[model samples]
Target: MADLRVELCGVSLKNPVIPASGTFGFGREYNEIYDIARLGAVATKGLTLLPRPGNPVPRIAESRGVILNAVGLQNPGVESFIKNDLEWLRSKTKVIANVAGSTIAEYGEICARLDGLVDFIELNISCPNVKCGGMAFGVRPESIREVTAEAKKNCPHTPLIVKLSPNAESIPLNARAAEEGGADCLSLVNTFTGLAIDIERRRPILANNTGGVSGAGIKPIAVRMVYEAARAVKIPVVGMGGIACAEDAVEFLTAGAAAVQVGTANFGDTRACLKIIEGLNEWCDRHGVSKVSDLTGTLVPNA
Candidate 1:
């Protein structure tokens, strides 16, 4: 048997196969399909200070090998999650509360609300700030630092994992900004900004016009960004983009990710994470690798 455990920011996971935020929901629905305990951790849907109804109809549309979603961070508010879902989720497996907010105060307050309650607090700066005229806090490195710092200040007891947006001008720069702002760990390659048009209607498929893209089509680009951010930051990097199988997860590990998050694949196969875990073990055994962590950043350049 191979060792599959991974430790990030002092939290030890049974394995490195976490489910990305917004994709896994609160875990109750998926738990009906498979044991939620089987996962390393579950990054819950992006939560805010207040609940959001999300965008209009047609928020999700499928591309050739990818998916575009402008769910608009729709989720139950932070207080509701604490009052209803927090304890049950913690009892099942590790919890990474994925948080989103419009202002620095909102971020701090939500983090404070979740502080000392969950296993980790994942700061999500990707959602648009209505007050800022629809600008996402994540697109700018400066805002990334500011938001990370504020959230860190409030969530002093829990480790902070800042999720970076791929839409940024420089991923590594934003990663460094997070570290500078006191991020204990970082997760990257959040869905890319994309859109699809309906030829017949001659309009955007998504009601919001633009949406975040994810799935197998994004694997290579995500791997590249993971490599860049990993090299630039001292903190651990949790990579996720288009990982659908064990080999795909290994690619991110080799690209310098401390762990990998399984996203859109879960939509297709409810048991995707479990299968990927099995695949990781099989691959490790076949390659004579004793520990999965040994594969991190093990990629060799072509001679």
Candidate 2:
């Protein structure tokens, strides 16, 4: 049998197959389909200081090989998650509380609340920073550093993982900003900014007009960005975007990701993560590999 264990920022995961935030939804509904604990970790839905109803109707639309979503960080408040789902989720597997905020102070407050409780706190600074003149904190290197530093200050007991947005001008620069700001690890290639129009209506399908694009179509771009970010930062990188099978996960690992996360794939198959985990194990054994972690950043340039 091959060893699949991987340690990132002092946290040991049984493997390196985490479910991305906004896709996993706290692992409750999926838990009914299979034992989620079999995976490495679960990054819960993006939570905020207050509850958000999310965008209007048609928040999700399917394109050729990808999906567009304007969910708008809709999630129950932080306090509610702790009061209801925290203990149960913690009992199942490692918990990475994906947090979002409208302001830097809100990020700090939420991080402080979940600091000692969850296994890790992942900062989702991709949303608009109301305090910073409506700019996304994750878009600019400066805001990424500032927001990460503020959040890190509140989560002393918990490791901080900064989730990066691909819409940035420079992924590596933004990644370095997070690392310098005290992030223990980083998750990259958040949904790409995209749009889908209804030809008949001659309007956008989503009320928000634009949404985050994710799915199989994004694999190539996501892989490229992950490679760039991994090369720029010493901290471990958790790569996501269009990982539907073991091969896709392997691609991300070789490209320089410490681990890979499955997002839209779960929507298609409730047991997607489990299947990928099993596939990874079988592939490792067939390849005569002792541990899967050895594959991280193992890509060789073409001669």
Q: After superposition, how far is residue 209 of candidate 2 from its true place, in Å?
A: 0.6
Scanning candidate 2 in windows of ten residues, the lowest lDDT window is 126-135
On a 0 to 1 TM-score scale, where does candidate 2 land against the true structure?
Answer: 0.97
Question: What is the C-alpha lDDT profile of model 2 across 131-200, one tens digit per residue?
Answer: 3312378889999999999999999999999999888899989999999999999998788888899999
Candidate 2 residue-wise lDDT at 136: 74
Candidate 2 local accuracy as lDDT?
0.89
* Candidate 1 clash pair list: none
Q: Which residue segments of model 2 deviate by more than 4 Å? A: 128-135
Local distance difference test scores for all models:
0.89, 0.89
Cα deviation in Å at residue 1, candidate 1?
1.4
TM-score to true structure, per model? 0.97, 0.97
